[model samples]
Target: MRISFSKREHDLLERIRSGDEKAMERIYNEYRNEFIGWGVENHSISEQDALDHYQDTITIFFEKVMNGTLQEIESSVKTYLFGIGKNRILQQFQKENTRLRHEEGVHEHYRFLAEKELNDIYTSAIEKTAGMFSLLGEKCKEILKLFYFDKKSMTEIASVMNFKSEGVARTSKKRCLEKIREEMTKERNGG
Candidate 1:
């Protein structure tokens, strides 16, 4: 049995889309207990672990909604949140072999939503990396994007970037990546 969002859910989803903080709080409050309960009860995950997973799920949920990956819900927002929670719990179960009980086709409905989320993750990753890479010099950006984003061969990159040979292109790309890494480290360390 499918469950679509009610009118109130539609309004809340719209507010979330509009970046309303109270809307976010409302959704967080609505699902906090139920999601944590499932993780703690079914998987025996610690409360802290459950809280961490819930936070990550919320991030992914916001990413899906804000980035336009989620549209025209086939189920209630509550159901969708549970589906994300279930996936997170399963990841833990795989490692520790924690308590997991399931019946046939139980998770089928959530598959579409989860798969849609996976598809968005790649694009979102690219956008995120692209943003960070933009902080580099233009030459570094071009070289790195050519090698990583465009997937151009070293030989091709050498020819395009006017490097003497594939060896030179490879060295240049390495140095460019190192510079980006150093910048990222400094940023993370609050340099």
Candidate 2:
């Protein structure tokens, strides 16, 4: 790609323009480690990715010089290299984020299916219990509904049902639960 090499840093620019391998090597050696370190600390980019990015940055720098796209080096070589590293690091992060989002969406789909299956199991169990509960006496049904379904306290059930005391309400609820348990057991055991 065409780049306008700036004239401000002509010495290094001229070296690069002449296809001087030493000049390129010097730049690579000078900043490669520093760039990689920065990549690790700031961007969390892998070492290999950092290496590849740095090389691409250098390549772009030379292309800018050779093609005369860069009229001058408006910024220092180090600054330009660092800018390229930052851009490449950002690209890596964006790609990683996109991948994670896709995985999360797939997991969400599976999780939704799992939760729906569990809910269906619970709903079936409730329906079965409701069918059996229909056989309970009116008093038993009222006590169970007030205590369990409505989440009423023993004292509240005693007040509503006009039980002699909270103890009576508790006793009645316990007896009703025991009867339901017996029926459930008999049904399951096919007695």
Candidate 3:
């Protein structure tokens, strides 16, 4: 059976989509603990594991909705959260091979859906790293910010950063980018 959201919940979802932090906080508070409890009871996940899954599910939901990928929900936000939480728990189960007895039918369905959804979230997250040049050393940061965010050419960036030549600026940018990629990979792998 399909679940429905009340008008207030629907409004809250809209607020979350619009980047209202308070609405997002309210949504998190309303569902996070309940989902954690559900995860612990049904999936045999530790309390900490349940909390991590809950936070990750909420983060994924927020990212998708804010990025305009997940437009609207037919289910109440609570039901949607539970669905995401179920999938996250199944993912943990598959990875850990914990001997937990979940209802086979529901587990199978959620596992399939969660794998796809999490893959999309992961992809989007990786793509977001292309902007990491902004976090490099101050000189590199300024040069890259001017080149990318400010739409400056190599010549312009060199002049802005007071480099001797465009070649030097270009090489610095390349090395900085490599450093950013290394950092991003380290972050993704939790190093």
TM-score of each: 0.50, 0.43, 0.51
lDDT of 1 by residue, 62-153 (tens): 76665456766789887888888788788663344221232113235446534556646433444445667767788888887677645679
Residue-by-residue lDDT tens digits, candidate 2, 85-159: 687677663345443464466557766535776656444445455787888889999899777655679998999
Please give the CA lDDT of all the candidate structures: 0.74, 0.73, 0.73
lDDT of 3 by residue, 78-136 (tens): 87888988886776643542222423444566675357766564444445444564456
Candidate 1: the clashing residue pairs are: none
The order of the candidates by TM-score, greatest first, is 3, 1, 2
Model 1, stretches more than 4 Å misplaced? 93-191
Off by over 4 Å in 3: 1-4, 93-191
